[model samples]
Target: MSDAEKTVPESADAAAPESAPERQAPRTLTVRVHRCGPGGANARFDDFRLPVRPEDSVLDVLDRIRVETDPTLVYRHSCHHSSCGTCAMRINGRERLACITRMLALGTDVVTLEPLRALPLLGDLMVDMRPMFAHIGDDWGYVRPVEKASTGVPHGVARYTRLENCIECGACMSACPVSSGTDDMPPPEARRGGHEAPAQAAPGADVADAPQERMFMGPAPLAALNRELARHPEQREALLHIGKGPQGEKHCRRHLACSRACPSGVYPAKDIMDIRMMHGGGKD
Candidate 1:
């Protein structure tokens, strides 16, 4: 062969750089989204397989399912970055906020998304949080006009200032046995059926209209109560009023799941203990 042809063989290594190994496309994940139409109609688990990026969150997958896969898949979320806990749901049986929960971190090929337990499932992953805060009256939910707001944490005092850390994500409420929806969880043998709302509207009672008095006061409200109790020690009698009620602290079995379910570390279970102690209902 000619010199040019011979040079071609030698030039190959110098002329061409090795191509990078082709980046594999993100693997598809099976998103098992529980679906319940408006008013809890046609409830069921609709599984959709979609390519998931490593950084994609559970909320991201749900959004994708809504936009790209199923338009009717209903769910609720707010401040999709974790500031608002509106996106809290059951992921792989644990209560968590969908926005911050990374899909890959789930460690399973199929990620199950269920509504937070212990609440009325409005639709799909959406549960009525209204009842969670029902016990905390408007005045109780907020710090009333203070002669002086806390300047800062007093020296050497472990004040319960992390109250603000509670985004009221409802995870604690979902985990609580007394949260009203815990009993509705389908047995493992039963498997997926459709939408299982914990407290189905009674014959004459509307789920929305059900009396808060009859509802089990969830940890969310108790956490709010803790804030009020911390600020106003004189309201001990008012706190006792709730403690003795049928749906009040008396209903809690001390499951302690509330603290585990809390994404922000609010640990409403501990707050419950404190409230009970002050009311003379809990032990020392």
Candidate 2:
């Protein structure tokens, strides 16, 4: 072979520039779930360690755990999106839609999961939403008329309509102070002189003589009632009657927790307050 015609292979170090970048290591996370069997049996916390990406949501973690680590892990999810609201649960002690809550964004190495409160526990990370629906009577319609001019409706259509804001996820009911109990409730005296006490207190009633056991229909139902009234003004008399009842808007302490917990921007607390105003409950 002539010196000029000699064949040579490229060295590994010389070819390193053309090589693909090294793959980054996946992040490790600990998922802590509040588990319970049917009828609330074997209640305990189950921690699952898994490698996950930053974009993975809490629902994704749960799916991986159930598929790979534990097939017996029970939970509810549908649509894999926030529209269904079926995957709503308490994430890190706050009400959230698991399908949309990114685990890494929570800024915690360990993610805590629990079923919503004030509803019957169906199992791990699942609650019975029937009670909330029962309060929100079936008479109310879910769709409401929207202005056709802005919606660009077809010429044949009479009007455009849209779904009501409430997704009925029961997050409001879970966060409601009234629905949960009065154990953590602040005294009437402590609650006075703030936005918390919107309704007027009776004369000479500075402190609660006794912890009044008020029966509340809850924030979700009252918000639904407000929507019902807006859709059908003819039903005002009947709906207002319901709002003024013992288990209606009158019982709400105006904690406003429901407004903060709602993922769909329903602002249930404001709805309850509006009903109270319609009932002649003066503004604070």
lDDT of 2 by residue, 1-284 (tens): 48736635479875456565555566898899999975557889989899978778899989989999899888889978778778889999899998899888999988899988767777998888876777777878999878445656688878877887788888888787666553255546653224343233233232123233344667889999899989888888788877765567766777889999999998998988888778432332
lDDT of 1 at 37: 61
Cα lDDT tens digits, model 1, 76-176, are 88798777779999998889999999998888999999887666778888988776767776766442344444666567854433326678788887777
Pairs in clash, predicted candidate 1? 118-181
- Best model number under TM-score: 2
Question: Which residue pairs overlap in candidate 2's backbone?
Answer: none
Q: What's the lDDT of the predicted structure labeled candidate 1? A: 0.71
Deviation in angstroms for 246 in model 2?
A: 1.6
List ranges where model 1 is wrong by over 4 Å.
1-25, 141-163, 181-215, 280-284
lDDT of 2 at 195: 31
lDDT of 1 at 44: 85
